[model samples]
Target: MNTYLRILSYARPYSRFVPVYIVYTLMAIIFGLLNFTLLKPLFDVIFEQVDSEVLLSYQNKPDFTFSIDYFTHLFNYYFLQVAEEYGKMGTLFYVCLIIVVSVFLANLFTYLSGVVLAKVRAVVIKRMRTDIFDQVSRLHIGYFSSERKGDLMSKMTNDVQEVENTIVQSLRVVFREPATIILYFAVLFFMSVKLTLFTILIIPISGAIIGGITRRLKKKAVESQQSLGRIVNILDETLGGMRVIKAFNAEWFMARKFDEETDHYAAVNVNMARKNELASPISQFLGVTVVAGILVYGGSLVLSGESTLGASDFITYIIIFTQVLNPAKEISRAVSNIQRGIASADRIFQVIDTKSKITDPDTPLAFDSFQKEIKFEQVSFGYEDEMVIKEVSFTLSKGKTIALVGPSGGGKSTLADLVPRFYDPTHGIISIDGHDLKELSLADLRKHMGIVTQESILFNDTVFNNIAFGMDEVSEEDVMEAAKIANAHGFISEMEHGYQTNIGERGAKLSGGQKQRLSIARAILKNPAILILDEATSALDSESELLVQEALTKLMQNRTTLVIAHRLSTIQHADEILVVEKGRIIQRGTHTDLMQQEGMYQKLSSIQSV
Candidate 1:
């Protein structure tokens, strides 16, 4: 229920449609009742030989009492009256005709209302998907490092679709179906409240049973959704590393692993469906029994001739009762769907509700230009368990490059991430030009730093758009200049579409060298005051490395740069080199000086040379 309330809050912006939807719902109900109510009179006129004066008067009456109401009702009366005039065969003909017309009009308006309701659902779901994407984009970087890409995709795709289905079904029941139950009950009650009361008693008992079953189904549904997310995550890992799996001959192993997760999903689904599927058949069975009980009791009452119910009235009750059955069944089915939607909602809301670990301070410093220095004062961090950076500190003078060289698990990358506030320091502080990093707006802080990681990030988009990603309203000339500096323009010009060529998903269509050059070009285009290069040239061959290195030198000039590289040769000429081990800075000096000191840096550099 709480989950549904949260989902409905999104519809607040479209509240104007609520009244319009209600009006349409009422019209559908009125038409449905007219469709059923016409049945009994036709039966009576044929079998009981009813009065012709009454039938003819109803056929042509201009009484203020009936009004035109609409052509459907008027035609319904006319068709029934004609049957009364034309004998038994004519009654059957008109009866079939009325059924066809009512069925047609009922279906026509139902379809129209469904289309309108779909529009409402589409708008709501679109807004929700947009909001979820925006939240994912804005979250702190650390979250993605620990989060599974496929699980997040499931939330956006599968989970949201579940919610959409529930909304569509719930609207039909909440709006249209309730109106049906009420209209039919009013007709039944006017005919005989004792019969109505009997049905009411039967309905609540069936509902109670369905409702209890639905609650258990909801628990199983939540488990099933989580299991499905795990399956997606495993499949993503398997497909993403198919090459590695084949090299190790692990196809059958992965297939077994996938089957395990899929089997768990199946088990949970079976549990949930066992309960939910019970609602429809049980309600149908109960409806049959109730109708039978009513018929037996109603017949006796009419035969006793002690009440208002005659043969016509008894037949009307049966018609209303049969019609009421469907709405009752629908309401139970809708409740089951609502429970499933709530399960998906819980997971989606979990993502939406997470507080970003890194957030800008309430009152932030806005820097016009970065000049003096970027400083880390007693910084420390950890990824859950062991500390990765501990009480380490450094200062980068304006326009100087600082290289962080370290053994594996030495926190070199974690330290670079701090400049953009990707993860807040567990203790102490980091500042740019005397203002704390956390005290600057995240967007403004990131605007000053450009980063390139070991994995070259590229979207399936035109080369021009990739270069211009970090900037707003980048012109063609700006893209050309950045590509030129990055040494990417020459090769890009030779491509079929030049700057307009689409880089297929993650630049898969481009060569390794081409992708690296484009990454450099994108960074160069941003032209940030600070730059982080995490082994940016590690993936390229020697020739590609040489080309990328040349571009890196040009891009790094006049920018405060932090470089993390396993190839100590690349950072040998940096102004300063800090050798990290465990979570502390074990050595800090010029590369030549570190070599003279014969420390961890010297040992690693010697290993690389050998």
Candidate 2:
């Protein structure tokens, strides 16, 4: 119940719709009850069961009162007058016309209530999905690393969609259905209090039976959602790594893995469906049994001549009581669906309630430009338990190019990531111009830096848009100039649409060198004061490498550059080269100075010379 209410609280400022919906729904229920209430008069007239004494009593208007009896008497008084003034056929037509009009108003108000509820559903979903997405966008990069992309995608898509389907469908059942049942039961009690009391006593038996079936549905629902996430994860991994799978001739292996997960997902859903499906039939059977009991009991009372329920009124009571089953069944079904919705809501709120570990301080320090050096003072970082970077310290003054040469898993990338505040250090302060990085707003800190990685992350967009990715309203001349600086202008012009050509997903349409050049172009357009290049040209061919290296040189000039490279030739000209091994800087000096030392740098330089 708490989870359901929490999910509903997203729909705020309900003053616009809730009151109007209440009025329409109440009118709908009242008129719908009127449809059943009129059945008694129509049956009495059809069977000619109206007593002559009762007819004469209805001629003089009964004194009006607040009770239902007063209203029934008032309607009967007018109905009998019409019958006497008109013929029997005319009275039949009059009663039928009233029934038709009541039915029409009932349906119309029902539709109006549905329209209002739909608007509320749409607003709730829009706000909820937007809030989930907003929280996701604000999360730290480390969150993505620790979580599956497909799992997150499932929460945003499948889980949220589940909440929409079940919760929105249950909304009407929660409000309108119970209101309908209550109004119908009120009429039943008014018709025959003894029979209504007997019927009410048996209703809880159906509820208890249905409740037992749906009790475990929530736990199964959670498992179903989780299994679906794993299936999505498998699908995503297969699609993203199709090249690797085919290259290794692992199609059968991938197929078997996918089948295993899908089989589990299917099994989980089957189990959930078994429980969910059982609730309806059990409730329905119990409802029919109760109705049968009511008929037998009420029939005896009428046969014994001890009840005020006339033949037509008893039939009307039975009709209205039977109508009660529909809403009761819907309520049972809604309970099952609400359980599923609560499970999905748990997953969605987990993401929304996640507190991002990386956030700017409440009172962040002011930072406009990089005037001095970036100093890492005894910085150490760990992923879980293992320290990846230990006591790492360095300083790169303005306009100086420093290269970090290291083997794989040597914390080069981790050290570079710290500069952009991707992950805060575990145990030290990284200060830029004597101001701690933690004290600066992330946006202000990253705005002055640009990064180009080996993967060359480019979106599937036009060349112009890709180059000017995050900027707003950039002029064409400026974009073209940035392309020229990155050595991408010539090839872009050679393409069929020049700057407007659509690059396929992740720049799939471009070659290795072209993609890297576009990445460099994007960085150049940002024109940050600090540049971080992580093996920018390591994956290209010789000719492509030369072109990309030239672009990098242009981008690195007159900037505080931090380069992480495996190729010894690329960093030999850097003002300083740090040889990092096992999370510590073993050597640090000018490239030539490091080469002169009989250490890791010289050995690596000698090996690359081969």
Candidate 3:
């Protein structure tokens, strides 16, 4: 219930529609009830059973008041007037005309209320989906690593879709169905109290049974939605790793995994369907039993002359009572659908409710530029009890270069990540220009630093857009200039559309060197005070390496640089070189200074020279 109400709360300004919708709905219900109630008079005109004394009494109109009695009496006053003026045939036509008008008004107001609900439905979904997207965007970088990409995608797409289909559609059913049943029963009781009371008792019994069944359906619904998320996860992994699957000939392996999830999804849905499907048949069967019981009980009253209801009035009561049954069945079905919708809602809220582990402080220090050196003091970081960076400390001053060369998993990249505060250290302080990184807002802390990783992160956009990414109001001339400095303008100018060419997903259309240079151009465009190049030219071929390395050198000029390199030649001219091994700085000195000694730096230099 909490989740269901939370979804409704997104429909802000409910005052815009709720009151008007209630009015339209009530108008529809009251007029619709008149249709059933008119049946009593319809029989009177046809059978010539209108009591002369009763007809005469109705001739004098009742004073109007805000009660059902006023409308009932007003309708009879006009009804008997038509009968007195004409014979039974004319009276019959009058009654038919009134019924037709009531039907028309009922349908017209129902449509008006539907329009209001449609607007609410559209607003509810738009806000709900937008909220999910915004929350996901603001989540810290680590959350993406710990959660499945496809499952998150499922919550944004499939889960929102489920709520729209089931919960939003139930808005009308939730409101109108119960109101219709309640009003219809009000009239039913007015005509035959004993019969209406008997149905009232039976209704709760059916409701209890249906409620029990739907509770179990909610559990199955949770399982079903979860299984569907895994199916999407498998599909995403399979699509993303098709190259690996084919290379390893693991087609059957992926197929087995996909098939298993789908099979489970199908089985769970079948179980849910069995329970959900059971509700309608049970409600309908119970409705029929109630109808039959009313006949035996109410018919005996009419024949024995123990009830105030005449034969015509009793028949009218039964007809109106039958209309109540349809809404009852709909209510049962709506409850089943709501269970599924709430299950999906729970999944969506799980993501939206997650508090980001990393956020800006309540009172952040001001930092617009890097004036001095960045210092790391006894910093350590770990992932779940296994330390990856331990007691690592280093300093890189303005207008200088510091390079970290190490083996894979030596925490070089992790150390670089700490500079940008991608992940805060588990212990110790990292201060920039005498301000601790945590004391500055993330936006201020990262604004003056640009990072170009080993893998160039390019979106599926035009070259100009990619170069100008994260910055607005960037003129094309500026983008072209930055590209020229990064050695990217040459290739971009030669393309079909030049800078306007749309690179495919992750720059799939571009070569590795081309992609790297574009990323460097993006960093250059930012003109950040500090640049972290994580082995920027390591993936390029010999010819492309020379081009990308030149661009890196240009981008690094007059800026503080923290570099991670696998190749020894790339950082040979660095102001200082750090040899990192097993999460610690094993050696630190100038490249030539380290080479003069017998160390990992000399050994690595010798191995690469071979």
Candidate of highest TM-score: 2
Which has the higher lDDT value, candidate number 1 or candidate number 3? 3
After superposition, the stretches of candidate 2 with alpha carbons farther than 4 Å from their true spots are: 60-67
Quickly count the clashes in candidate 1. Answer: 0
Residue 184, model 3: Cα distance from true site in angstroms: 1.2
Q: Residue 506 lDDT in model 1?
A: 85
- Tens digits of lDDT, candidate 1, 532-555: 999998888999999999999998
Sort by TM-score, top down from the best = 2, 3, 1
| Residue 382, model 1, lDDT | 84
**What are the TM-scores, per candidate, against the unseen true structure?**
0.91, 0.98, 0.97
Candidate 2 lDDT over 1-610, as tens digits, reads 8889988787778798889999999999999889889998889889998788978888879886898888888999889888998968878898999989999999999999999988989988999999999999999988999899888999999999999999876898978899999889888877788889999998998998899988999999999999888888989999989999999999999899989988998998999999999998898899899989988999889889878898888888888988999999999999999999999999999999999989999999999989999999899999999999999888888999889987889999999999989999999899999998999999999999999999999998999999999999999999999999999999999999999999998899999999999999999999999999999999999999999999999998889999999898988889888889989999999877887889999998889889
Supply every candidate's count of residue pairs whose N, Cα or C atoms clash at under 3 angstroms: 0, 0, 0
Off by over 4 Å in 1: 48-105
The 0-to-1 C-alpha lDDT of every candidate, in the order given, reads 0.83, 0.91, 0.91
